[model samples]
Target: MNPAPDPELALEVLTDLVRTDLEACNRLIVERMQSPVALIPQLAAHLVAAGGKRIRPLLTLAAARLCGHRGQRHVALAACVEFIHTATLLHDDVVDESALRRGAPSANAVFGNKPSVLVGDFLFARAFQIMVADGSLRVLDILATASATIAEGEVLQLVTQNDTATTEEQYLQVIEGKTAALFAAATEVGAVVAERPQAEAEAMREYGHCLGVAFQLVDDALDYSASQAALGKTVGDDFREGKITLPVLLAFATADETERGFWRRVLEERDQSESDLDRAIGLMQARGTLQATITRAREYGARALEALSIFPDGAERRALAGIVEFCIARAR
Candidate 1:
């Protein structure tokens, strides 16, 4: 049997690779963002310097190396993918009116919405330029499709805001579009660049899809369950923003009709209060919905791991396989 996956092996494989491309990404971002007006460069650089996981591009590089690719272009492409993701985040924070990310003020909050949104558009344009320079029509196609899906997912979440009736299916679609599609695309492009067989390429794509889903599910779960110190944001940020995340969805189902009055007030009524959050948390815990939410995330994690068995055993493959647990249990 294959050996058990290394828990931190993903982090290990990512260490040097992420560092190298992060430097390149930083350079490229600065080079492309320069303008006659200095504010553009200044604001964009501030957020880029703010720091993030940069996991999107790291996934690309790791996936490519795992599939036996040796070309230097993968590094450039990975950085390009990260820029696209970062751009989206700048835009997202503005749209969500979120104040904090990774324990700091968001780009929109600091630079104001106009600069954040405009800079985001500039990044998107720069990403496309870099992607096309690869001269791979297939790469452009996948990235295009994934980008459109991301837009749709964001709109879906916006439309579904505070709608307690948001179904699991709807939630899945939103997550797939908004978060997982990019992950799937980034990893899939790695396999595609390596000229892996169609089946294996498809396997990597599915692995990314499932892994992205699990990652977002756990992120949503953490919003309700983790403390600000641990999560780097307040619990119930979802509720405050009228987001009906997985834990909230479960709580809606499991809460008694009487107790659900509290949910309705917090999620539905315009007059939501601080006490409403306390009551909702208590009711959700009492009904075990928070645990159920974690269980739901675990099931996705299992599926993500299942998709990885297709690749042959190696440190890279093992690390890829182990990432599911990290994504699912990241709250701890």
Candidate 2:
């Protein structure tokens, strides 16, 4: 049998395959982030320099190449995707009151909430400028709708926070809106720039949607199980913030009254003690909820892989398939 796919290795391979385009995209991101107001660029640069996997923008570059795009339009569109993602991260840090992002102080922590929020708005406006410059109404519509959907998702998650009665379906809706919508838009716009047919664009959209769901599920599981270095943020952030994730929902579904009291006290009342996170993790482990969450992520990963079948056999397809492995393998 083939050796298990290594997610880091897979990511490196994808990065190498698109190294040139990725460089161009990075340059575009830097160019577009500059402004007359130094703080706008300074604060934005802090977050941008912190660096992420750039997975969403990578999807745009890879999907366009997979659809036979040879022009430079994908570079601009990829930059637009990154701007949108960065803007969201800036806003998220403020709203979540998160101290860290990607193993460093978050923009809000360094620049204060006011600067972070305004800079995030600046990035969003810059993204719109790029979209209009591209002159594709379809691209604009896809990204615009995604931005709105992401907001709706964040609001839905806010509504469900600290609510132990949050259903699995409700949790899925939250992720699909907040996370999957942008992933879908990122990939779909690739086909749009390439001028591919609607069916192909839909396939890419499906792939990204499934991948995004799997990505978030794995992230939620890692919050309780992974090391601080692996997680790139506080391990118990969700638990501390009373964010309802899949693992919590699964564990809560099988809890007795005594255990329910523990959850209510910690998650609902936010009356957490020092040992509460450990106890919460222990409950999830004994109940196998963490593993169950990973299993669910793998199911979505499978669907993401299936979505790529319509594309012919090639390195781009393989790299995209490996990305699915990369997202799910984080749970391992």
Best candidate, lDDT = 2
Best candidate per TM-score, number? 2
Pairs with steric clashes in candidate 1: none
Stretches > 4 Å off in candidate 1? 1-13, 17-30
**Candidate 2 CA-lDDT value:** 0.92
lDDT by residue (1-332, candidate 1, tens digit) is 23234544555555554466557655765687777878878877776677766677777877887888878667767767887787889889888888887777887888899988988888788789988888888888888899999999999998888788999889888999999999999999888888889887888888889889888887887887788866765667887887878778887877778767776777777468658777767777877777776787778777777777887777767667667776776755
lDDT, candidates in the order shown: 0.78, 0.92
Residue range 58-116, candidate 2, lDDT tens digits: 99999999999999999999999999999999998899999999999998998899999
What candidate 2 gets wrong by more than 4 Å, as runs, is: 1-4
